[model samples]
Target chain A: MLYNAFLQAIREIKRNMMRSALTAIGIVIGIASVIAMVNIGKGASASITQSVSKLGSNNLLILPGQTRGGPGGASSFAKPFKPNDLNVLKSSINTLEAVSPVENTSMTVVYKDQNYRTNIKGVNNDYFTVQSLEVDLGRKFEKSELRTGQSACIVGKTVVKKLFAPDENVLGQKIRLKNFSCVIVGTLVEKGANTFGGDQDDLILVPTKMFQRRISGNNNIHMITVSVKKNIPLEEAKLQIDQVLRESRHIKANDEADFTILSFTTLLDTISQITAILTVMLGAVAAISLIVGGVGIMNIMLVSVTERTREIGIRMAVGAMAADILIQFLIESVVLSALGGIVGVLLGLAITYGVAIGLDIQLILDPSITVLSLLFSMLIGVIFGISPARKAANMNPIDALRYE
Target chain B: MIKLAGITKTYGSGEVATQVLKGIDLQIEKGEFVAIMGPSGSGKSTLLNILGALDVPTEGDYSFMDTNIRGLSKDQLALFRRNILGFVFQGFNLLKKTSALANVEMPLIYQGVSAKERHKRALEVLSSVGLQERVDYDPGQLSGGEQQRVAIARAIVTRPKVLIADEPTGNLDTKRSHEIMQLITGFNREGITVVMVTHEEEMAEYASRIIRLRDGMIEKDGHHAV
Candidate 1:
């Protein structure tokens, strides 16, 4: 009996082939977009975590701001920290591993006869260790080179590629930056673009003393990065630095601090939380589309019940139980939904792959999620198909037979 | 054998109450051929529907082979209809999209007969109705006479004990009507009691007895002039 009913359901679906196909299209597109968006979100999240992990977790950045607990709290875009304040923190903190006061300058670099606009950063040798950077060629600046403020520099991989051809050696070459000439002593390893859509390998690095004296002629540093010992807890290290900076700057008790210290791990957590919330909001929007598709299925099933009223009457007249009619309609709805799901999976994967290539991100498809979404669509069919099927099954055979 | 005592059927309610059948008492012995005849609204169709168990009288005791039928549930009546009786309608009532063979096999399927057995029995009955060559043709492709023949084949496919037809020749010409009446008579001769309704006296002559109704009551009951 079940087999016959199943065959009948399939035959009925085939009888209205065009309408059935159109009805399934809605579910297919809805499910496809959901899968593509979810997978892209997952891949983007993984890439972000990996990139943040590359920056040492023990690293922290401190920037000068307005003193808190005055009339108003500190504003984020206020003046930056000065080099003297960084020196005081470096000399006073005992648990600190290294400190680098960083200043940025944009200049047209002249290598031989070719010149290009590049970002130049001035920092001591400790900046490499604090940022967890490795040199691919030559070596980091010598301690004497930083103290004496020599005109020596390390070039990023992008500058190296632009100024020098692949076959030629760029190490030990001289590049002119603004008012002075500097010799390249090493090349930094290739670090790809950062989250803010900037290439990490498009900058030149020189000693802080050289930049303060020769290039910018300024005492203020744009940023200060502090590296703490591995054994020290991050929060404890932050508190100790805060106290030392307060005393060095001569701030009284019950006074707000004069600077903001931010740990890399905390920043990572904040960014990840924001992205997760966005992903959930977007997923909810996709779910609404699926609901719309479910309603479409219900509408079509209702029409189908009306169209087959005579068949229903005949079946009931010949001794089929009411539940049998209900089951047949329910099975047809599920079959339509499942077929839509299968086609939707393929479409979503194709879209994801295309977008991943176009935007250059990873395509990470989770099988568990795909299966769950497919099952959820089938559940939607059953949930939505029941009322219409019951309505059809409950029809009086006498009235149904009389229907034209 | 089937018996009806004080059967009454009415439609609507209150001031517009219209009775379709009233105080109908009738009987048919096993293997007997019977016909019911009346003009439009004379209640012949309503009586036939009640006698076939397709409907229930508003007030009546309907007994089929000594079992009270009016008290049977819809599902029980459906089972009773499938196992012991068959129906032939004026419209032929074959599923339009299916073959004559499949239509003939449908009642047996409801009886839960296996596919091989159903196919064998449907083939046998189709041949008995002279539709052996048209068994695989859909009802839409067949002529009116052939379609009615297929309906007869389906009605007798399960070897039902009683065959009830409502206006079996209402849609056919004289020759086809004669052919259909002949088929019903042959089944009756084979020990399946036949109850048929017709307005034509020629068709009524084939039955062993005739019951005429008027104003929702039986006006005459006797053998036709065959």
Candidate 2:
């Protein structure tokens, strides 16, 4: 009996093909938007995770001043770290693998007549090791260059492109900065963009001793990069470094530390949390359309029931029970919504694929979301279809037959 | 075999109430061809609806073949209509956009007949009604007379014990009307009880018995000479 009703519903839908297509439009758009938003959000999240992890997940940053609280706070006026603090941290913490004091300043680099404004960072060879940076061409600085503070530098990929022609050999080139000229001994490999939208391969690297004496003419270090030993837990290493820095800086237990320590894991967690929230927000906004689509279905179904009053009477008069009529109409709605869901999913996937390709990110299709979307649309059909089906079922055959 | 005692049907309630069938008693025997005749608003259609089980009387004791119809639930009434009764309407009431064979197969579908049997039986009945070549044509594509033949084919497809037709030929021309009467009488001669409602006295002449109704009451009942 139900099988016959199903076929009957299909025939009705096919007979009114234009109206059926118009009615399904709302569902199609609703489902398509939901799928596209979720898929693109997932792809973006994946890209962020990859880039954050690429910045070396085990590294820690030490910045001079408390990051929180008011401007007149105790640590607000604290002095920056010096070379002595770097040595003390290295000698005190057993879990420390390598530490490098880094100082940076924005300046212009000129090779011949071409010049570009870029950041110049000064650090020892340990900075490259701690950051997992590799030299793509030429070699690292010799010990004498670090000790005597020689005017030697390694340029990043962005600097090389800006300061030299494609055919020019960058290793033996001389780039002038401020009033001093430095020989480029190496060029670091490319590391693409970071999560913060900054290009990681757009800087020049020089020995810390050279930068402090020749450029800034100061002994203060702006920041310090530290790497924990392979087997040591990051939290344990953080605690040890925090305790040692407090003690060496002569800060009492009751006083707050003058510096802040940030671990890579903490940064990764914060970034992931933010992206997850954004994904959910976008998905929710897209779901509103789905609900609206359901309402559209209900509206059309109500109109359909009213239009087919006499047809219902005919079926009832021919011995069709109320249940049969109800089932037939309900089946029609379910099939319509289910068809919309299928088309929406396919369209969403196609749009997501196109966006991933355009943005140069990995395609992420969450299977669970796909299945849930299909199920939810069908649920919309049933939830909205009940009233109309009941109206059709409860009609009096005599009155219906008499209806002109 | 059918019996009706004091059947009364009223529309609405309170001061607006209008009684359509008032205190009517009638009996119909198996294989009897009866035509109910009346003027407009005389309740002949109401009486046919009550006999078809399409509507329940306001007050009545109705029985067919020993089964009390008033005591049956809505689903049970529907089952009774499916198994023991067939209805033909004035407008020919064939499903729109449906083939003639499919229209005739509708009652059998509710009877839970298998597809193969339904197809074979529908084809056989369509041929019996002289619509064998028009089996696949929809009602819109067939002439009015052909459409009436399809309705008749649908009415008798289930081989019901009783066929209730309300003005089955009311929309046809004189020639088509006589042809339809001839087809219906042919079925009545084969032992199927038929009760039809019509206002035309000439159409009533084809029935073996004629019952005239006036003011919701029976005015006359007698047999017609062949």
Candidate 3:
């Protein structure tokens, strides 16, 4: 009986091809948006985790800030740490393997007439080892160059691509940094992009001494990054560093510290929480469309029942039970919604793939969500289709037969 | 066999009440070809609806082969109609846009007949109605007479115990009306009890008995030599 009803319902839908397809569009858009939002959110979360791991989980960033690492706190105009603080933390903290005092600037580099604006980050050679970087060609800065404050720098992969030819011998080449020129000591390996889609290889690295003496001409340190010993607990390292920095900076024991330290774990957690919230918010908005789609189905179904009144009357007179009519309408609505859901899933995946490639994030399609979306669409049909099906089923055959 | 005792059907209630059929008591034996003739508002349609189990009488005892039909639930009435009665209408109520064979196969689908069996029986019935070549033709694609023939084929496909037709030739021309009446007569000759409603005397002459209803009452009922 159900099989026969299903066949009849399909035929009925096919008879009014344009109306049925138009009705299904609401469901298609709803499901498609849900799939696209959820999958993209998941892909971004995965990409964040991947880049965080690549940047080294044992890494800790010490920013000159107070309270949380939010925009206001991180970019606070507090007293920047001096080179003395970096020296103190290096000597006192036994758990720290290496610490780099970062003095950063965005400066224009010139080589003959070819010029490009890029970030100029100044640090010691220890920063490269702590960050697990390698010189792809030539060599890193020599010990004498660090002590003498020489103008020798290593150009990262992006700077090399922007400033020189691919096969050009870049070693010993001098590139002007605004006033003074710096000789390229090496070419850094490609680091690609980070989680926030920042170009990691798009900067030139110089010694902190040369940067302080020639570029900024000051002793203030903008940021400091340290790598903890492998066997040491990260929390203990943070507390030790926190205590030393407080004592070195002469803040009282009861006073709030004037610095903030961020670990990779905390960054990952914050990003993960944000992505999860975004997914739920977007999915919820998409779900509202699903309800609207269901209402559309109901509207069309009510019209269909009225339009086929004589058909229902004829079927009843030919021995169809009321339950038969109900099942037939119910099946028709479900089939319509399911077809829409299928198309939505495909469209969503296509959009996701395109966005993933464009934005350079991972593409992750959750299987359970795909199945859930399909079931939810079918449920929408059942919920919205009940009244109309009952209307058709409970119709008086005499009146229906006589309906013009 | 069919029997109705004191059947009355009233529409609405109180001061607005309109009585369509008033105390109709009738009987028909096995293999009887009966024709009911009446003017408009004579309640012939109402009587046919009660006989077909499409509507319950307002106050009456209706029994088919000694089984009471008045107390049967709506579903039970449907089963009774499915198992024992067939209906053809003046409008030629074959589903629009459906092929002739598919229309004929509809009643058997409700009967739970297998696909192969339904096809075979639908084919045989369509051929019996001389519509074998038009089995794939839709109602919109067929003439008035051809559509009526398809309807007749559908009604008889289930081998119903009684064929109930309401104004079977009301929408057809004289030539098509005779053609349809001849088909009904042939089905009746096959020993299936035929109960038909018609306003045309020529169609009435095709039956072995003629019952005339006037103002919801039977004015005359007896065997008429055809």
Candidate 4:
């Protein structure tokens, strides 16, 4: 009986093909938008984590003072972490792998008249280990050069590509940083962009003394990045470092630590939490469209039941049980929604693919979501279809037959 | 065979109450051709509906082939209708967009007949009704007389124990009416118990027995024995 009803439903849908097509359009658009939103959101979140991980999981940033705001503000005179703080963490914490005090100077780098205004990071040789950067060409600075504060620099891949012609060897080439001439000893590999879409490989790295004595003319460090040993957990290392920094600055247990010890995992978790909230908000908005689509199904089904009153009467008078009548109409609604769901899935794929291509992100189609959407559409049809089908089924045969 | 005793049916309540069928007794044996005659609102249609198991009487004992139809559940009554009874209506009641062949096969579909067997049986019945050439034509494409013939073919194709037709020729002209009556009587001759409701006296005369109804009661039951 069910099989026959299915066949009957197919025939009836074909009978009103135009109406059916129009009815299914709502579901198609709803599912498509949902899929596109979720996938793009996933892609954005994945890219953020990837970019953050590339900057090394062990690194921490210690800005001047305790004021929490954007970069480049006044240092609140609240005893900033000096270069001495790096030495204190290194000597005190056994889990500490490397600590680099970093200072930045804005300089015009001129390589044979190819001048580019860029920020330069001044740090010791241990900066590479602390920041998880790798040399793509030549070699990193030696301990002697960093200790004596030699005027040698490492360029990132973006700088190398911008400063030199394609086939020209940039290593050992003389580049003028401000008034002082520094040779490029190495080129850093491309690290892509940060979460805020800033290029990570667009700057140059120089020895700390050159930036402090020649560029900035100060002994204070703007930020200190620390790396912990691989065997030790980050939380334990953070606690140990916090104690060292507090004691270095002579702050008592009653007083809050002046320096912010941001571990990489915490930052990743924070970003993930924000992304999840956004996803839920966006997904909820998309779900509204699905409900509207379900309403569309219900609306069209009611109209169908109204239009086919005579048909229902005929079926009943010809030995159809009320349940049979109910099944026929119910299956018709299900078939309509199921078809809408199928086409919606395909439409979603196309939309997701186009968005992925246009935005240049990876397209990850989650089949679990597709199946869920399909099932949801079917459920909507069944739930919304019952009242109309019952109305159609329970219609008085005599009155229905007499309907004009 | 069908039997009904003290069948009473009413609609509405209190001052608005309208009794559609009063206490009535009827018996129709197998192979009998019975025509119920009355004017509009005379309860002829209601009696036919009850006999076909399409409606239940408010008070009555209805038995068909020794099974008490009044005690049958809705689904069981639906099964009884599907397996043992067939109906023809004045509107022809053929599925409007479907071919005459499909219309004839509908009852058999309810009987769980296979598609191939259903098509063969539908074609055979359509040919028997003189619609062999128009078997694939939809009801709208056929003439009124042809549509009625198709409806009759649909009715008898199941070879049901009884055929209940309400106003089968009411929507037709005299010539078409004669043709429809001939088709129905021919099926009755083949041993199907035929019960029909009609206001036309000429249509009623064609039956071997004529049962007259007035104000929901049986006025007369006469045999023509032709």
lDDT of 4 at A140: 82
Q: In candidate 1, what are the lDDT values of residues B1-226, reduced to their tens digit?
A: 7999999999989999999887999988998889999999999988987877667889979998889999998777778877888888888877878999989998887788999999999999999999889988999999999999998988898889999898999999999999999999999999999999999989999999999999999999997545
Clashing pairs in 3: none
Candidate 4 lDDT, tens digit per residue, B38-117?
A: 87899999898889887788998999878999999777887888889888998888888999998998888878899999
Candidate 1, residues A1-404, lDDT tens digits: the string is: 77876777678778789998888887888788888888878777767777776777888877666534331344646565665677778887777898998788799999887888999899987898897777999999998888878888899989988888788888888899887899999999988878668898999999888898888786667677889988988898898878877776677768977777777787678768877887788778878888888899999999989988987776665556667779889888877877787888899889888888787776789887689779978987898789889988788765676678
Lowest-sum lDDT 10-residue window in model 3 chain A: A67-76
- Tens-digit per-residue lDDT, B1-226, candidate 3: 6999999999999999999888888999999999998999999988999999998899989999999999899999989888899899999998989999999999999999999999999999999989999999999999999999999999999999999999999999999999999999899999899999999998899999999999999999989777
Worst 10 residues of 3 chain B by lDDT: B77-86
Candidate 2 clashing pairs? none
lDDT for each residue of candidate 2 in A1-404, tens digit (9 for 90 to 100): 88887788789889888988888877888888888888898888788778877777788888878875322232535688877788889888878888988888999889899999999999999898798899999988889998888999998999988878888898877899999999999999998877677998999999999999899898888789998888888889888888888877778988978888887676667777887898788788778888888888898889989888988888888888888889988988888887788888898889999999998777999888889889988998898888899999999989988888
Task: Pick out the ten consecutive residues of candidate 4 chain B with the lowest summed lDDT.
Answer: B73-82
Please, what is the TM-score per model? 0.87, 0.94, 0.90, 0.89
Cα lDDT of model 4 by residue, A274-325, tens digit? 8888978888888898888878888988998888888777777777888888
Model 1 misplaced regions, further than 4 Å: A56-58, A64-99, A110-114, A136-138, A160-176, A180-183, A192-197, A215-218, A226-264, B223-226
Please write out the lDDT profile of model 3 over residues A206-318, one tens digit for every residue. Answer: 99888988998887888899998898889999999999999999999899888888888888888798899999999999999999999999999999999999999998998
How well does chain B match by TM-score in each candidate? 0.98, 0.99, 0.98, 0.98
Could you arrange the candidates by DockQ from highest to lowest?
Answer: 3, 2, 4, 1
**DockQ values of all predictions:** 0.47, 0.72, 0.75, 0.57
